[model samples]
Target: MASPALALIVGTLFAQTARAATAWRFEPPSTSPTEQSGNYTGFSNDTINDTEVVEGKVFNRFVQIWLENTDFDDARTTPAWENLTSRGLLLSAFHGVTHPSEPNYLASIGGDFWGLQDDDYYHIPENISTVVDLLEDAGVSWATYQENMPTDHFYGSSYTSHNYLNASAEDYTFYVRKHNPLGVYDSVSQNKARQGRIRNFNDFANDIVNGSLSQWMFITPNMVNDAHDTTTDFAAAFIEYWLFPLLEDERFNDDGTIIVLSFDENETWDVQNHIYTLVLGNGLPEDLVGTTDDTFYTHFSLLSTVQANWGLKNLGRNDVNTTMSNVFDFVARETGFENTNVPEDARPLLNISGFAGPLNSESYIPFYAPDDLTAIGAGGQGVFVSDSLDTSVTYGSLGESTNLTSIDSQSPWIVVEDKSEAKVAVFAKEGNGAAPVTTNMLAAVSAAVIIAAAVYL
Candidate 1:
């Protein structure tokens, strides 16, 4: 062997070379040449110009951590979660879109589930543009960090086996493709450049140390750590151990960084489909820490919040109407163009039956009906009406003098009985008809118009 001094020098030189090679630095792409050449070839130029004109909360980075299968009550009791809540903004009324986990994950990044209800290995078509497309168009970098994934861009139901139980028991590879929503989309999977961004969690540390972190980063823990195959305490411990350090790191905390920690869905379907959602980072105001925001939000709201901060266009889905306004103060004025308040009837009720796949069939048929509209008590004529903007009308059998609360509206209504059946209608203020047939019909018509506006506006 060579002398100790010589060996030490060689080792130091190798490490410096490695660091130099892997150092992550971001340089904004040069669009001046295209502009100078008089080649306004793509929509990016127009998007940049339009978005810059609007004043909004501009964030340097956004990081999201998605946990799995934990109820809001159970998750809040954990010390780790409680600690995070004390340091961040807690969303009390945040909810998930649906059950069985897959659709919620898809909705987080893709705006819509595309009618996905099961956890099968799905290949979404290329025509469907995800939030990744939006990020790229806005000149922002994005990536997905999944724990225990076999390698970068790994695409499969599970890393090793199709069966989750077998994979968890045999190899301890709990990385499931259902949790990796971006990997399933053809827009990302088919494109080599985008697929390369789906990296294992090990790369997260390397990127951080090398200063290569992207503008938008999505993180998914393994099944065991995320509480899917384990308990809430276990997931809590995992988060505290892994995330607390990053929160303290200057690389992630500097320059308006926002971190969102949320669960994919609730454990039980009987209660309101609320899940734990926490927003904490250096970007938030010091006074706002530990504040509770009781905003009616969903996964679509999270997507919209990011778009609002980055000045990106809506994906023309639920995100267009479901923007979260209460979290960021500047958001309300910036996103005035969007219909931030989603009507109570417009929201999809968590349908557990939606997860019921055919016994023998390989694929699941998407169920369109909302499960929250079950008949209750001795039924009469019941109509579920939208409180804000009179957009939706759902006619059903109502019980005797039942009080139904609108999800979006603070207005209260009491059911009254008519001769044939209890015709459910909006509660009149001073002097209004008991049940206005023409108004109810108009409400249905307005729903169609609002839906059209949501799609194209």
Candidate 2:
């Protein structure tokens, strides 16, 4: 007979192999840090919730629900927003990075908007990295949920009146790609598997039911529902239609989940750019319930907090800018990362628009190769340098050579139509006059991510 110790080890390995062979639609990467260091000399992998759950410092699941341009005062006085105050920690000083919408969404994930000051079309070069690159490298599961998104990885500028749920008004535009951040990146769009992961609410429902909810989730409601085309009360009605029941759903908000209810930016830009943000879910410490967190936070904090919680790398952009990249206090405290308290008077005037970056036609400056390799991120990890990065080039040379007029926003990310010879294709199409993108979206497929790590101490 086999020795008891050997049998035990065999049994554990067998169980892991079985779960990988079955039970999961996605497999984590072999580079998963959780499966490396913590996979050994410790208890079972802390990812008991789902294959995607990597066990962040303070929470296992993070769900960010982004509404649109309602100011702090406007949203706070609304019924749902008022009632929610007593349930979660309210962030009083969270502000948007810039005006309009797309860039703010881009800033949240990519760290910097790459000088994009307008809501117009843009596709950051594939060479530029984003949080998704870091999350996958570390073996974390992530996805976005766009309400009324016609199909997975739909590249349209906006999908109209496809309300299968019959939840929103008939005439409202259902989904807009501008509000969908990851889709804007060539890094994500060009990768077929990554494109399939940009899913609709139907997939969101299925993931919840299957208990395969991604550890990181971004949820964007329709234009009217997010308050972009409506009033504060209009958005409150959406909260009732959408968020209320989610609060009580275990699949959506288990004890380890934190759901962030925040706006992309404020409506009244002149008044200091503060937006109402609420941190809800069982993850909130009981003692801190109904409290107000005054720590200075911006959309970049979205990237930093996730990085800190998971011990992941940064994009080497604004994520290292300590001024704008303060991790959420709860996450910072738990992860041993410090956060700054920006005084109201000291806050950057975020409302003023135009000439903020290279995309600001009047202030156009070519992309600079950000000096990020040595810079430490909020997680205490160095910036993520792309494997495909041009090693031969120096920042000085590239900065001097770059031309704003010659750059194409969608050139590399979007495969040209008849110009297919100019670009490769999985499928090519455009939406809402969005710089040409994919008409042939990738179909949802299973993927595996298994890292070879010290399985036993």
Candidate 3:
């Protein structure tokens, strides 16, 4: 028989172990490579670029975070105390609309698709209210930390490759400048005008190091750094790099803040229709780690959260239903932050009635051509082709030989994994140097392909 003292000691040890297990620390990754694919056509270049540029920074200042990192057990791994989980809130500003950058960023905060779509930065239209207005109205400080934003203004007319484009929309930056005039500022020193809220991506890094910024920040990486036209790994690397220091900040450890990572929108057309979104915070449940929230959400939902957080009035329509109340855990805790009280067994509102089947099914295929492509590339005139591994597979158009490879490359469509058939369209040459173009050819396929990978990190 065991002695009473031994039994008591065993129970005490078990309790201690459980307590220790409950304590955890979340630090941003050390090196965020601009790689990692998402649900789209062939490679996820845009995803990779976004991650790297947004997060990349000076090594000296950020290194201090890891050098003085600590576990969540209230133990002092570093003397200065850098507990990421408790102090920092990750506020990721996603560029939404389509794979192209500018419209996506506008959609992320504005909650509406601006008139001019596609990633192209030319022909910017004005008269759009942005989330910046809302954030400013609420007195929540915010800035755009773009990796290589030329001339500070979104429409500085650099005509450079700094723009992140997709097979669909190209040149995303100019739209932001056109839509939000408030972002333009007059430089008294130079006796000229410059962008107001916009700053170089590197400046954001300096702000993080200097602690000169506010509670909310928006980051946009350069063309290569932010995965605008690269792979998903690039984006991931950038995020991890920037996030590590913030999570390690001593102030964030003491105060409760939440960080979020999300994609603006998935590929132009099909496959998995959902985008990626991640939340990192000290108050979040530990069990929530490496989990997927496959809830049906639109870009507007993100806008709703920002609106609520900053006390912005609703934008009406779809934006009204964009509350994240369903996904967050609101139950109050010892930490004096607002609790989210989300249930564990909450069912996602997947539109199964609208959704047919997985990509592999014969009947599950979607209309790869006119419908999807038109939605993505309708506003512009260009041919774009995908980098699908299978040469036999064709999306959007019909006839392989006649379609101009040059035009096909400009086709404005999201690559759908499961397409039942292809469609095409042809346009006659017009007066303004517009050449006669033909698109919408069909090619048969043997199997279905899915572009999405389920990643839990």
Candidate 4:
């Protein structure tokens, strides 16, 4: 094995090469031809880029670039967005599943967000499966890239980067764990192999040049770049500086790849969860270029589209809810999957935020097991139920379970301490079946130990 001195020299050289290729300034990233290597990796052994050549019915690669909290009108009217619309199909009627950022992001991959309402950190129970589980099952490579994340598999709440724009600048909270969807799920965060796949922008640069890009990628820019803490204009410019050039690179976007550019949720919470969305890549038909699709699509559409394209199992939640999660029109056409047409009046109030769900509020309920029997996916596969799921009861029946005696215990939104440690589920012992109580701290560490031992050992 190489000594520490040798490692340091190699690291310094790689960083220098990455800096030169990216053409860094006091701004967002630019295009790079080869490896964009840096200290942004998780473990030295982490597989940030797990590449595979899986063929799909429609697109082989699916890349999701997420911006934050911009209304559909605001994004559409932005001068910077205009430049991007001409290169791909504009999804005029696309909507976010819920308000705030985290839930919609979770919904994008895991079929359902499990009712958690705010940006507070919380990990979904392991029994819940995600797109990563499906992809790996089907041999489709996937990974997530957070722009300014301190490390690849970081599970922290937030990190400030004084060196974001320039070294002399005051450190700012450029990265937040709430925005990184996979980090919120225990199945992903706790799994060593999968956790290593959570990389940063620098790794993205490295992945491209190494010819190691994954087939499925979820890319989240830093707070300022994603408009979470900045303006849509700033985000548009960042995209123009970064993603715009990559659109031309076949490694980034080929005829077999589909790139989704979307906002996490709309700024206007009063309106239905309408958000600006764009679909690009050479995978898009030439005839569809610069055109508009008025289909009623949601974040879950991406989930359905990917599953349909790759012939994978469904998570059996909103992803299978045809009315709520319609497949992309072009993808539907190619895959022989029919897109759902919901009447304007019959649509659910998507603007509805925080009605209390799993791991949400003070009266938090147990995570539900999906009904594999009914969750039929567009790929013609049933739901993929994990071994850890509690099959003794029906899904979402926690509130009615006889194990809970108190009225407070029956409530779905359980109150807990507001501390910011990683949220986890503590399965409380009942006279009968167990009920889950979520607490970040101010609870038994032994319970987690017992649960961990029970689940893993």
Candidate 5:
């Protein structure tokens, strides 16, 4: 018979091979970092001066177009912004400005981006509460699961306190070295305030499965499994295998849970600029499946939607009126609205960059990174990106298809179209690296480019 140790090794290898074979076709490049890029990695500031990859043709043609425009400079110029009315889901290009990760997270839920300068753990501020408070006021149940929070304190934050319950918490602890083998000291010290709310990430699934959590639920992946990358392939795999299924459970029917997967912010420079948000949930249209939303949306818009849906009080300057408006329409009709505000012309916002045909395999870009940016009640502002052609598009308006034209270096302008409501901002690209050279003036070019592109578009 084969040796026991050898058998175990062979089995492990086979499992790894099988897992790799079946994993999602999309994988970060081999250059992915080991430490948590947290939110900023894989970002490139270069825009496509000319067609790097031609559009159309091949196995993953759309993927090709995405890759060709994949760079920091390209911006969220060509994403498909779907507005999910009663008909289908509308995805907007979710983008946040700034370098660190925490502030963007605050933007997504609380608005105003909270000015959280660092990702270091700190007690919640007294002046600033979260959208969780708003949800609670609106009678919406929500939960946040931090992986590894121990059972004795389901709301624990320390690595030792967390218990990975199959469904819920149980009174379990281990003793070693004369200390609670799982140290509860750190969490006890750090979470001096509002310690009741935090819980093990596992609890999120349990709450959803057991029907204990309210309609609104928030999940925070552990520092590692959240694609922060302590372990390679862990975050992406967890999302694909574990989290997606939990969100799809039938418990949410009368009022479906709108599941949003986003990054807190970019940490590394490479992947930060093109961070992505994946929205999956009930009442989403099937025809709009697998589409991208290219509208410029910051975290405040996300908070605003949650506020509107739950009837919660606004938290910051960003969420008040400037936030995106179409997110609530799926349940709007059901909430007894006579005529919903959802727009009719539904399709992806089109970008005419590199209109050349037939994309080659070399320049393919996959969406990565998810960050938060707040814009709600206070002195909050949301940044918009677009060219001259898009300025005429309405702000905060959803379910409309937009068309863009070629960007000549001489007239490079980006328009901000808010289809969810009514706002059109016209701005231009700044600086030139390797370029078709849209504008002649080298200094202060971004401002000049917008003026020119607006005039022509």
Candidate 6:
């Protein structure tokens, strides 16, 4: 038996301990902050110089709008997309890195998907640098504006769900964590200051009005607006409603600014993983409007183009080979389009055949086969194999042989396999967990725990 005061103090301390444990449980594991040398972290200590010029012009601002899931044909049918094409340069041969979606988003920023086959919460090692490192190194300010985000740096899934069939008439959670790549990486998530820079759309609007926009801006719309669940027409309408006005705004129309609009991946993976991509803004030459540039480009091109513009170092990934220099003349002049070819040894590994099941099927998991297992066959059922270099290989259930050596070439490949099952699981799990707490919140709770323990003693 204990005194009433002692019992009360112990109970309170136990409650505090439970709460602190809960907070720590939900919080992502933190890594040591990348060493900072000067104003930037994760870069060399040498003083950065930004003297490099692109196409005899230096762009001070780069803005990108990332849409979701709409194929090129469907996107082209949308009036809003047509309007943009009429005003900018459309890339006819642009393709996403792979399917279904998360890898493409990761590839766009990190330059390599790292064989990430699903959208599970991934805390990339801090040592794995991103475009943020390059931008920060060159003294360029950058931010990601996510529409419908619950908080400034909220790293959860869709806030809520509405019937996609009634998307136009109903309200739903637009902010999706998978679509916002920066939040997933430990390099940004573990850094309070860097995480703070990822603000909601309201902040983006305010920044625009206040003329306080960053040099680099990445914008992702809500599910409904970005066509993740809705039709392409719906997404186009949303873009028309929101983005058209910005084109007219002087802030985005300055000669030093460039705006890129693209999709994360296509609707179906059975066909080529081609997506519509366009470049517009004051930086585009007047003569190039309403024209289609057929340069072969991938998400890597976007990263490389930015690096070229800022004279930044590469992350030594796919960005080194697949840069879209010809698409952006500035990059082409500095580093010839053909000169940035991907090394034969550096191509991503391909997982040929195993199991192709529903995204929610128990068999589905985020598995990346070893790089050496380029052609594998097991389970003795539906066996499909193909790569970027060999486009004529037969696909479907195997009948006679799994021998693909005749069509397999040494050229760099982009394998578009069935990842929709994993994607479905990833999207369904969004916003399913507790919100993560900040460092200050953790520290305060820790101090409270210490005090409570002292009082109990």
Give me the runs in candidate 2 sitting further than 4 Å from their true place: 1-52, 162-172, 356-358, 391-457
lDDT of 1 by residue, 287-321 (tens): 66899876578888777777767667555555654
State, as a TM-score between 0 and 1, how close model 1 is to the true structure: 0.62
Report lDDT (CA) for all predictions. Answer: 0.58, 0.68, 0.33, 0.74, 0.35, 0.56
1 against 5, candidate with superior lDDT: 1
Tens-digit lDDT string for candidate 4 (1-457): 9999999999999986774464333364433423353423332333344565899998889999999988898988867788778888999988888877888888998988766667765667667789988999999998898977878777777877665466565667878888898987778988987877888877777777677889999999888788776678878778877887788788788788889999989987998888889999988888999999999998999889998899999888888998988889998998889888887677788877755455454334446666545667988898888888765433444442221224223222232222366443444333454466444221323343223323321
Q: Candidate 1, 436: how far from true, in Å?
A: 55
Best-matching candidate per TM-score: 4
Model 3 misplaced regions, further than 4 Å? 1-102, 115-117, 122-127, 157-194, 251-254, 282-292, 321-457
Residue 167 in candidate 4, Cα distance off native in Å: 4.4
Model 4 stretches astray by more than 4 angstroms: 1-26, 29-51, 400-457
Q: Compute the lDDT of residue 261 as modeled in candidate 3.
A: 50
Q: How accurate is candidate 1 locally (lDDT)?
A: 0.58
**So what's the TM-score on candidate 6?**
0.62
What is the TM-score of candidate 2? 0.75
Off by over 4 Å in 5: 1-92, 151-196, 230-233, 252-255, 267-272, 321-457
Candidate 4 vs 5: which has more TM-score: 4
Q: Model 4, 61: alpha-carbon shift in Å?
A: 0.3
RMSD of each: 21.0, 18.8, 19.8, 11.7, 20.7, 19.4
Candidate 3: TM-score? 0.44
Candidate 1, superposed: residue stretches over 4 Å from native: 1-56, 160-170, 322-330, 333-348, 351-457
Worst ten in a row by lDDT for model 2: 448-457
- Residue-by-residue lDDT tens digits, candidate 2, 1-457: 9999999999999986774453111111112211222111122211223464577789888899999988899889867678878888998888888887888899888877755666765555666678889989889988887866766776666656633334342544657888998888778876886886787666665566567778888999777667776566767766765677777888778899888999988877676778899999888778778899888899999889988988998877888888888988888888899787678788888776654243443333333445656888888888787776653332333322222233322222222233445333322223324342322221111111000000100
lDDT of 6: 0.56
